[model samples]
Target: MIHTLSISELTVSRGERLLFQGLDLRIQAGEAVVLTGANGAGKTSLLRTIAGLLRPDAGEVAFHDGDGNPLDERLARGRETHFLGHQDGLKISRTAREELGFQCDWLGHVQCGMDDAVQAFGLAPLLDLEVRRLSAGQRRRLAMGRLVGSPRALWLLDEPMAPLDARWRAVFADQMRRHLDADGLILAAVHDPLPLPARTLDLGGLT
Candidate 1:
């Protein structure tokens, strides 16, 4: 099944400051779009809006099926999308194994391909350690386990590579490519260029 995200005439504001206005974008399956801009340029805001985490001041954000029919808002945001923000969203007290179990459940999977995810992220040895004991990069890997444990149609990532070392970053880049090859959609807010081919959109001109 193919899915597409459409954003039309979108406007967003934070407090008294206006972010972007009259923005439009369309992303189809097997595609990736990278959002780029200086700090406070609303890159994260755009991603959050599309993820249904924030209300847009104007316009519409919707998902369409391969046939061009719109999907229910609930299904679009809940079942089809995965949002990974800067914060790893891990409980410091939980062991990596416990957290991964919870993440797989929360992602609506029955621990499918979980072993593969552990191997892919090199998480076998770290699984017994508490999240607080994990380094920044380790925590990031643990948090990302959901991307493999359970697959979703769309991924919204905010600086996904920021915490990783060069090697893990390369691993994640390969994962993103595989996602695209499997007809998944990605919208990422990134400072550095993504290691794969992706369309770049700069969210400039804040007022």
Candidate 2:
């Protein structure tokens, strides 16, 4: 399997606080890596670093194609890899349908069905409702809908199951399994057990 992401001797610091030091991690295609740690253990920070939202103080994050050669030419890190943070990123005044349309437009081509996503997320009745009026779990479901249209090979999800109910969680687990089976990679920060074949990377142990 080709390594999609590689981190070498990564070190990150916020002010005087050391987030992580001398950390090395490599994630390959078709693999799912679960990031587990207590709150404030730098799990989100690590995800941000990988997503290129924050630069590490030291070390390199390299991307490779299926041939194992470096794919350093790619500029948009979030383009080829979807990063779903804890924040819903929804426009409060916008309706659910509008938000989905905006995300689809940003993603270029739409491979997934918007109606299907709304149905899957149980947002059919809330499609015309403004996001600000939705519950916390409903907002998360809407955010997860963004992934439906993504053509990305890697997914960086922070608390993906946070607002999902039991049924939706099961559906999401199935979706994750299908993603992995299709040679996609996932690195997620999860509090509960993820029902996928995943390798746990404890951020707290990196020090």
Q: Give the clash total for candidate 2.
A: 0
Clash pairs for candidate 1 = none
Q: Give the TM-score of candidate 1.
A: 0.96
Q: Which stretches in model 2 have alpha-carbon errors above 4 Å? A: 1-3, 73-78, 111-113, 205-207
Report per-prediction Cα RMSD to one decimal. Answer: 1.4, 2.3
The residue-by-residue lDDT of candidate 2 on 1-207, one tens digit each, is 234888889999777888888888888888999999888888888888888888899988888878888875244374677788989789999998899778766764455567656766677888899999999888888887767655567789999998888988998888788778888889999999799779999887443
Worst 10 residues of 2 by lDDT: 71-80
Clashes of each: 0, 0
* TM-score (all chains, Cα) for each model: 0.96, 0.92
Candidate number with greatest TM-score: 1
Over 4 Å off, model 1:
205-207
